[model samples]
Target: MPKTLDDELHTAGAGASGRRERAASVPRVAWLIGPALVAGVAYLDPGNVASNMTAGAQYGYLLVWVVVLGNVMAWLIQYLSAKLGIVTGRSLPEVLGARITNRWGRRAYWLQAELVAMATDLAEVIGGAVALNLLFGVPLLWGGLITGTVSIALLVLQSRRGPRTFEFVIMGLLAIIAIGFTVGVFIAPPDPGGLLAGLVPRFADTNSVLLAASILGATIMPHAIYAHSALTRDRFATRRGGPGARRDSGDPTRRIAWHGFGISRPADEPAPAPGTSTEVPTGVLVRATRWDVSIAMAIAGTVNLCILLLAAVNLAGVEGTDSLEGAYAALGVALGPVVATLFAVGLLASGLASTSVGAYAGAEIMHGLLHVRVPLILRRLVTLIPALAILWLGFDPTLSLVLSQVVLSFGIPFALVPLVVLTAKVGVLGQWRNHWATTAAGVGASVFLIVLNGVLLWLVFTGA
Candidate 1:
């Protein structure tokens, strides 16, 4: 006979015991670190490079506050996303999907999200193509093809080897990105006084306001918010009546343990009574998640700042430094070939790693929001088409990257408003629902982002 849901849960719980025993030998914190790092890749994609480079090159330290502000807000937002998944065992998209009862409303929501994800892909694939051209003189069309192909391979790795392995590989790429982008700052540091002065919130012109929006868009990505919740859900959520279950049970102390990485109840602890709460040790998980998010954001934020500072100190007021290709050539002239090559390498790594993550986010978005599970390969191809088309049509790659970020900025409110609403709902998260202060902060960030995008539109339309 086919097994029932309870039978499946029992089998899963039994299977988890051995893995938990094995995990007991490892450090507890190691189990919680990977998800945020993977999600954080969104903040460092090619869009970020284009936005920050243009900001510093064109304005020279004028928009430093935007980068810093975006990062600060990202920390709070990412933490809320992770907390929602951990407490409820559902991703943001999954939650939104189940709650939006109207079919047309659900489709409408998915459409905007789909556009945002495609914009993300366009930036990443284009960045890869530009990097390949810079490094090996590959034509843009072929380079885009190669980039898309390699990203598919990475997604395949995630499918076959599991999330832990995928995390390790992405983390390795992140290291290369960090080193590649930040090495130049050491070779030629920014003016300390100018850097300090840039901290004061101000804009140089309408163009600077546009770059600031692009920077915020590149930094606080909608897909990353969607992905982080899903990442946590995948990594930590348990089967029904298994670990991390939300239902109440007889045994109050029967906390959830790591499923594959192996944290289990101590040998001395009493066995869980039948029908115990399936809740994991949420306090422990939340603490670890905070550390995970902090580390990931710190790395992403530093690399982005370094990219801007590199351009500000060296490429400021330089003609033809606004584009990635132009910036690469200018870096070679100003800081020599080694620095330029490293920057290209970092851009390449950023493209490769972030595209894989972006593709993963797109897949989750479809599955959760539409409740339709398309094959990953098929989904990857569909998204890859837009980026490739831009390259084939001979649109300016750097300009495309920056504009794509601006598009992302516009989509931010759709993701952020719903997230703030859901996570703050008492019925949704129970005791873990946002406190007044947290909810207010989320509201404030959402409002600020909305206002910033409005200013960008006004400036463009009015020519102010």
Candidate 2:
């Protein structure tokens, strides 16, 4: 066999050159893609449409800033999670699982993951069923069954074909989303300044509190954290290093490595010395992560922004949709039955998209929490059963979906506080840890959200 130069180089110094190749092959604004495709479409879920519509129609563009603010915060959070995954070779769960000395810390993380997964499933099952009801005149029970079946089917297809194939299909659906939203904006053009004003924060009585809560819930989610972590781990090709191979694993050394593609030998045996040079795998992991987060978050943010704008123009100022029921009625009046049907279907999509994400997140939680490792088939059934039953019992679909968002809303502050504390610690993220500017931005964002949420809750209770 004649060894070509490429082949020899590939065999001889694959790690170094492959890493170099990775640097050179960085996606051109293709960097702007991957993560966005993951979150953006899901963000455009039918429930989000209703929230934005409810906001815009009632407040007319006044609350648009709420969505923007939530997204800006989300961008920062997702970036940090991905960056940590890259730098640490650990998802938040793994990081927390190992870092927290106490059992309670570990237990809390497990509980949250489990609750979020179940709540998310509830939202998705109901949303999909509702959409079926709108589209095919299917009953709630039948629609729930259908949604469960279809989502399971989609999961099978995704697992078999891989993420690229699955994400591509979702991206196409997102395009349809863009078309639908863009057309909606055209059909009922919003006031430009009013839309602009919506970006500003204003607090008052009325159900503006509820509107704010909805926007926050739709934009910031616990599943996204799990999804981002798992995705980062999946996207990153890791070295199967064994015990005592530490090249300063916890030192958080300020090193950055990039990779194109390289062959790796499984950790054969004990290595030579501390100063001896072997590429640190964690460095490469972190860099790729930043790329993933930056690209994905940008796309998700833009589409989310568009949804708010669309709502501002079409439904924000309308009189009818003061509540969920009002939203259905206003939708019919403004865009007629055809468009209203589309919104319901959109809601269904939101639930379905998020449900799958919920299940995936749940699986990860199980791995971290109960140390349970159920097969994916069993896992799917376990989550689906409760959700379907809820639908069958005549649980109010819209309200239940809305509650899922609320759970997400609360989960954000809890999940993020730990993330900030854990990653900022010198022991965990080391050189890749949060710097001054980043820490400030993250903490400020979390606090602001908590305060807004508090106000929302206060109003909800007092009916102020």
Candidate 3:
């Protein structure tokens, strides 16, 4: 017999026994922070640093609204992605692969997703290499190679340590980024009136629209769209009624014992008796997931906002500030070396951690779309080669990062279209399928992105 929703949730919550006892002492919201933080890395990567910095340096706070809009869209999409994993017990790629009955369609999707992954890695590697060049005087080509090597080492570390350990590492790096940017905002605050006005939302011209699109691509990354589901799926070893019906044995890494994630229940709510149907609804879990995504994205959005604000304040009129390195130097001269170093350090941290996350997403994309499991190491190497070639060809690193994000914008439809389709399908999601409001929002966001990409491509070709 198939397990009911209550059966699946109760079985999953069984892992909370010790957690429940401990929760009697502390809070549970803190437990859900890790997976969302991992997902949030997608928004705070080197691509975002490049795009947000460019927006601030070029247009000042005029483009701040774009960053805000991009992050809001990202959080919505990421929430759906995580909920999909939680409800279906499968990642988005795995779901898409199952649904794409035609072999040719799967292959085509796989090709586009691979290209997207490469674009993502290109930005991350360039950011890492640029950071190395800025801080240590390493040459770009050599820095590229070192960046690749260090990324591999981090991947190896993750495999050895398991997912929870890996997540803690990412969270630590995210903290560094948060601290650096917070200090930056203190040093170079944006004009309060102008910053508030930027939130009013009107593009000044065509170039502003293009930059906004790039920022959207950078914030709502395709790889992240693929990876979040996998991350959440891994958080629970079982879906609902399938197998052992027990919580995963994987040691959850949290500072405090997570008693339970019952958003619908009061803090003092008693645990449901074992083997009894708990009145706790699946909606409770869903709400809890959104809370996690909200907290994580809120932090990420703030960081991105700070990046744009810093650039607007310090590098708005500075020549040659288009690149991350130039921005660092300008900040140093305008503020101090410590502020400059913080920016470089934040970039480096973003580069390293997001590269690792990007690699994980690439693996998911390959395995999901193609059903072919390439070794993770081989996948990382495959993506690394293109970044190396870009450096070897002497492309400007900052410009390359910006162009890579633009390429990512072009690839968004492949992921977004399918994501919207699957989440709305009642057959797949059952009670958790998107409500009408969510469906409308998802479709609207998807259409908006597609139209934006269309306009961008037309602009590029016609030189309008």
Candidate 4:
């Protein structure tokens, strides 16, 4: 006798359970994508574009290794941050606040998050203004003002939709960057040897080191870490599940406590029951996160890799780029005006979108560390002012933007340590605790970045 319809439903349910299991393993591959998306936006920020061009133009492909190395280092740190949130249920800000028993420790975390915002905001405004400047012969001051106002408006536009709207907008910006840069590459094909040389670590003179620092620094962001951890929790919480079934409270530390995560609980919740054994829902977890992470990582990582290749090809040994506009001028000579214009437009979008994220991160830090509930608009203003000043000071918009990358290089340490410490604490992650291998890698990477930054700084000061 063949099975009836009822039996089919039972078998279908079992199959669905396996998908959920896979999804649980990966957590909506989309979740993994959020960080990469954020990274893409950061990678295309004003400073990154300028520095990458300079590296490519000056040394051809000698500095290509910086992009790979930086991304690898950053990937290591970010992966740990993600793991920390998934296992601990607490974001970086929350954990930092919790860890520092003393006032000084608390102050350091908050202050650094604020610094990250300030520096990030500065880069964004400058990037945006430079775009406007390149697109239309606009004055830097006016451009900066407009840039600041418009970014705040973007946040307001998304206010009704909730916070992650900024991230969505940033994703769109990343697309623009990809299109523009890809077009630029098509225009000026890269030389194979210079491009290959760029993939290797070279210590050729002092300026190379500074440019390399900028590239590495591009990955080190305090707020991105805070934002990543928080976004995971926020996304989890919003996924139609309650705390016990889903643990979605933007705290990476709460994995087992989620209920509304589309899973059902006996009685009221999914808490530990002494005598009853609970079967994990096959439908809920698997189809959700795994695939999303796969696509997101691929998109973000590919873009980063492409950018480095793009820079190595176009700018390597071309010369005379005092500004991003200058870099554009060079690109126009090698490539074409149309491609350069597209790049500027994309750069504009990247800066503005990332600006909004910077503001949100700054506000979160203010709220978490200082317990100060500042208005979002005010926070935006606070973050943008420095960037505005930089433009007003008659500084080269492109160079200032590139130097800001160096600021990130110095700040990476502030964010990395707490992430490493919190994730490695076995009590927080339980069985999800970082393996000894992962810990060693994290420690080694952090130390290397620290040393790299130091040498870069020494070179910068010596003007070699």
Q: Give model 1's TM-score versus the native structure.
A: 0.89
Per-candidate alpha-carbon RMSD to the true structure: 7.5, 6.9, 7.2, 6.8
Q: After superposing candidate 3 on the true structure, give the runs of residues whose Cα lies further than 4 Å from its correct spot.
A: 1-27, 239-284
Candidate 3, 21-121: lDDT as tens digits: 11222223354456778978878888888888998999988988888888888888998888787667678899899889999999988898899899999
Please list the C-alpha lDDT of all candidates, in the order they appear. Answer: 0.86, 0.63, 0.79, 0.64
Best by lDDT: 1
Per-prediction TM-score to the true structure, in the order listed: 0.89, 0.80, 0.86, 0.81
- Output the worst ten-in-a-row residue range by lDDT, candidate 4: 20-29
Instruction: Report how far residue 61 has shifted in candidate 3, in Å.
Output: 1.4
Model 1, 418-445: lDDT tens digits are: 9999989878877778899999999999
Model 3's number of clashes is 1
> Higher-TM-score candidate among 1 and 2?
1
The C-alpha stretches of model 1 lying farther than 4 A from their native spots are: 1-27, 241-254, 259-280
Per-residue accuracy of model 4 over 1-464 as CA lDDT, tens digit each: 87542333234434434532122222222322454465346556666676776776666677778777776666666566655554444566766776678988788767766776787888888888888888998898898888889878877865555434555777777788778766766666666776666666777878788888887776556667666665544434322343112332233222232232222233344354443322222222222333333344455455555555666666556666656777788777767889778878877876777777677667767766766778888778777778888877898777787788788778887788767776777666655556788888878877887898888777667776
Which window of 10 residues has the lowest lDDT sum in candidate 3?
248-257
- Model 4 misplaced stretches (Cα beyond 4 Å): 1-36, 163-166, 238-301, 460-464
